[model samples]
Target: MLGTRVSAFLKLSKRDLKYDLPASIVVFLVALPLCLGIAMASGAPLFAGVLTGVIGGIVVASISGSALSVSGPAAGLTVIVLGAIQQLGAYETFLLAVVLAGVIQLVLGVLKAGMIGNYFPSSVILGMLAAIGITIILKQIPLAFGMTETHAFEVEDGGGIAAFTNTIFSSINWGATIICLLSLAVLIFWPSFKKLSKIPAPLIVVILGVALGFAFQGTSFALNPDHFVSIPVVSSFAEFKGLFIFPDFTQIVSKDVWVVAFTIAIIASLETLLSIEAVDKIDPFKRNSPTNRELIAQGIGNMSSGLLGGLPLTSVIVRSSANANSGGRTRQSAILHGIWLLVALLAIPTVINLIPLAGLAAILLHTGFKLAKPALFKQIYKKGLDQFIPFFITVAAVVFTDLLTGVGIGIVVATFYILKANMTNAYQFNIVQKEEADMAVLTLAEEVTFLNKAPIQQKLYNLPKGVKSVVIDGHKSKFIDKDVIDVIKDFEQNALSKGLSIELNDVTYKQKPLNGNFRLKKQKLQKVV
Candidate 1:
């Protein structure tokens, strides 16, 4: 049975490999620059990002059920990792947090806590995507202009907007600028050629960048060495092991370690879940990735990465979208991409370094445009204030602050909208004309909660003294909050004294079944009139 299963698996792998191979190469190329860029942004070792990409691909993909979702070191976690590393004052200590974070995620997956991601409001999620998009553009501006020594990535720590501006003004390399614009143009207009669907724009951009790098060599227009990728060349197995940094177990008892651990776990898991959801939406097959399983895979991936000196890893949308767009059909593409990363880092680091950073910046700039597309903004605006407010605020907050803080702000805004909608839709109080006089009707909605109490109370207290009759009916309500019931009870108890006659009928369906679907449910209330 084992032999037969292995044979069938190999057969399927082979079929997938054919289509996935090309897609994996695209993902690898996209992932390579992002890994290095994010690692630099995070203030960690450059190789840590490559290590993360390798682990995300080989370990995470092997365990994850997501077909086309690619995992890797992400830009979203740059802020978190940077702060944690600075706070801990040591990279090895930070590794302990990454490992602990994996444990937390593992527990969450086992407990099915992955469902927490489902509760995040869509407006906030869209806002997050937009915020990251805008942040990407802002961060890439310096790089695209060849401001290589500006140290703008540190702005995520506490530098804020002013530091980023300083970076742009301080340095400018015209040679890098020329190449960056050329690469951006290719990325922007390359999609018009439908015949080039199989060949990605990023690949072309990189090739053009390498060609530019060589062109500029030993000439008046020669670009600085910093303009190119600076991946450390690992020549042999002996040197490879030296690159890996082990976690400091001694820091495990420190509260900072535990705190940062949970922080990374929550943020990384959230990023992973959001990325998986976004990738699944774009999947041509429309296949659903199991959320809980993805979390577990991510947990293991992070743990493995931490042990081997890597930055945090997650399901990365930029790479996954690149994979899906490149015709990848299965998880093999993701795994193969990781293997490719490992092979490159171990064998051809020098060749990889030939590509220019400006070229990568162009690609990211293009990605930023896609994420913060004008059409997306217009679409959200058309959805009305409820959606736009949170989305816009989230984007603004993320740009001003960091990722987690901005997400918190967006969630708060989103929650406010939820409360607003709930309050508005909870119930209704209207005065209708009757044969003799005006009859006030308090029609309860599907569900009325304590949140609806203030408005409902105000409406009841101002129930025109001239009213002859008032009906407090919840005959159709699925659920009536106790506070609402008490408010109605108090008003009814005083109705007779106020020269009003009140008729109170079924206020809740707590015990009595409705629509032959719900069990017996009813609200208990004593009638005063």
Candidate 2:
């Protein structure tokens, strides 16, 4: 079996080289600016983002079962990373949390917890995503317009709309704003052209920004050096090696570290699982990836990233879709993209430094807009109050508080709705007191749980006075809770005293199975008359 597996992999690699090679380059181009932008958004060293891309592409891709999924630093985690860094007091301390988070992910993979992603309510998940998008947009606004002294998250003196408007208008740098607007234009409209669609818009944005940066040099409109990406420029192998920052292991005992670790592990795992699931749906081969193995790969990738002073990483749908659209058919494309990232980081630091932060900001802004599109709100609202309420609440909570807290609140609200529905739909009770017949019928739903017991009991005891016969039907029920069964038994015992005849329709009981499982016994119609 091992030999056959190896043979098949080798064959796939050889057959897909023509397609994978170009796809790898496209994915590399697509991942480049994103790595720097997400790292900037995360408030980590720019090099950390590149390192994550390298590790995700090379490490995760190597171990992952997914053929086309690409792993890298993602925008979704920027909010968590930013908050954790501030809360932990140091980047090194945050790194320790990242390392521990990876260990947690490894345990989860071993426990086959990949299915946990499916348990999160869809509305809550969508709300979380939309919240992240809004946060990213808010965070990038200052960068996009080249506001130097004012950080996006900072509070101004006498904070209000007037102060914000005055600060923003006064601090706006026309040079950076021009580049940002141009980049946004390309991102929004580039795909409309058939030929230009093949070239990634981000690559074009970077090139345009760099050219404009140089063009404005020595002029009044010249951008500050801080307006561009600032990765360390290393002259020797020793210098390159020294650039990597290690985690402060001494901080391991801090409670904040564990909280940050758990948060990162869960959010990263969820994003990875969701991304891979989406990638599989779009795969031309329609292949299903082993989610457990993907989690294991991501665990290893994140561990390597933490050790190397890199940002947390996950399977990114943006890069994966780019890979697929560019004809990538195997994991080779992802691995090769990592190699390109490493080579660029080592060899072309000068070229990369020329790319403006404003352009990267525009890219992130575009990503944010996609995540929180108005259409998404309309769609969720159309799903009804049960969905929209939780979704809207989650959005508000995340915006006001944090990701984990918001999701918890959303889950609680969603659970309440679920219980309410269960209580109301447990069974259908109807009464017919006509001259021809005075009969009442109680029909059990497909599955009845203990939550249904109260309503069932109340309805059973409150039947109309003129009813001559009462029928309890379970023909459609596959499973009935023991509590509900007890209620039925009690009703049977009291029916005679109420001067009503009792009948059971396809409702029978049997001993619990030998294996200690309780299953509803399906028998012919049983009567208790």
Candidate 3:
């Protein structure tokens, strides 16, 4: 009987609703606190975060090609959003920045710049993940300890880390702390069987947290108002309509507006692209998402979010990973999560407020551990120094500075190693000194750039001064920069004076010297002994 009902439902749902329905509920639970927390951290209205969640679910997921990635406002963007909000001085003015950011992202997609995502070094991306993880763990520590008045403003100059550190330890509530610790225990130690996960650990955390809140009521261990989630209550649809604030076009001319817009667009796009790459690696189905289309979908979502008075949105890895872990099988799971958020707002605003902030903190703390797991470092170290240095530097820089700045520093470090590799191993040099046939074979790398010039020149200079024959081989090379080729030609012209006969094999010469009428004295091609 049940089998027949399931079959009929599967036929009605294209066989996806079964997987998507429960997963959507799980994603909604995961997104709820994150959305509220991010909004609080960004200094935006609480409702704005929820609104972004809806758009990311319904709008971005509907258009995105990714099967598992969930779009919403990200913790990674919190610092930037915080600074932008303070500078703009008005939520509506900040909304203008958000709208402009969406436009810029749309232009980036139109220009086919999604391929830019491919250029980021793995070391840098890993560094970003680690840095954000560390930030989350540290930022949530106080909240988990039941220390209210904890905010995520940057540990900036004149204020430094001390000021931020002092703020967290001032007011401590034992009840919130106990609930948080117990909630983390459940999430961490609960049976992780595939069937067991259907009852998401986070949902359990919220339930327990709310029960704790009520159980300790009228006691010394009672939860503080600051320690609980608070959602605004609206009496009617018109009052709900009054909550949204639109963008201010009048501020569009301001340079700060444009600057913040560009900053948000670039960082948001980079984060989105990185998240897409990260999610694809973990996907059980091994599907690849079209990066360009993701940017376009995100752009549209951000535009809608801005117009609706919400924070900027991106494809967040945290929510997406949760969805995947919860057995979400389609994009329908993500879209349905948004619908859940919308439905909850219209029906259960009071119920949401009963969720403890501590419970949400526990969920994020678990996420933080996953992001910067100790095993990740051990794995990167096994790859050796050429990979580890850039990865470590990226992590340190991101933790100390911001994401964009850390990535910049990491890319520079990665580039240095690349240049060093080119300089040291640009080509292989071998000397064959058979009686009467003394030949030096120079085999160029597949792609020899100008960075390889110095080493190639040095090898040529160090060649046996009395060798009678030399072979500069490019048979395996796909590209040889003009400067490198010029060095070879220059050495060829200069070699004849030392009683050396030259043979150039499979070389593509490109330059002004090669362009003008030029003829080689000998047309011999050399073969390796």
TM-score of each: 0.87, 0.81, 0.85
The TM-score measured for candidate 3 stands at 0.85
lDDT of every model, 2 decimals = 0.85, 0.84, 0.84
Candidate 2 lowest-lDDT run of ten: 148-157
Across 1-529, the per-residue lDDT of candidate 3 in tens digits comes to 9977854532325577888887888789879878988998899988999999999999898888889999999988998899999898988999999999999999888888888888887877887777777878887887787876534334455465677666444456778888989999988876466677667677788889999999989998898787877767788989999989999999989999999999999999998998887777668898989999999999999999999999999999879877887688878899889999888788988898888888888887887788889999999999888889999999899888877788889999999997897788878998887787678888888778888999999989887745678888887776677798778878877887766778888864433455687432322234322
Kindly indicate the candidate among 2 and 3 with the higher lDDT. Answer: 2
lDDT of candidate 3 vs native? 0.84
Model 3 off-target regions past 4 Å?
1-16, 82-89, 150-171, 192-197, 250-256, 433-439, 463-469, 500-502, 511-529
Candidate 1's residue-wise lDDT over 468-507, tens digit each? 8888888888888778878888887777777787888787
Give a tens-digit lDDT track for model 2, residues 279-383: 775689989888888889999888999988998899987788778766799999999999999998899888877888898888778877877889999999999
Each model's total of backbone clashes: 8, 0, 0
TM-score of 1: 0.87
- The global Cα lDDT (0 to 1) of model 1 is 0.85
Candidate 1: clashing residue pairs, number: 8
Question: What's the distance in Å from true for residue 438, model 2?
Answer: 3.5
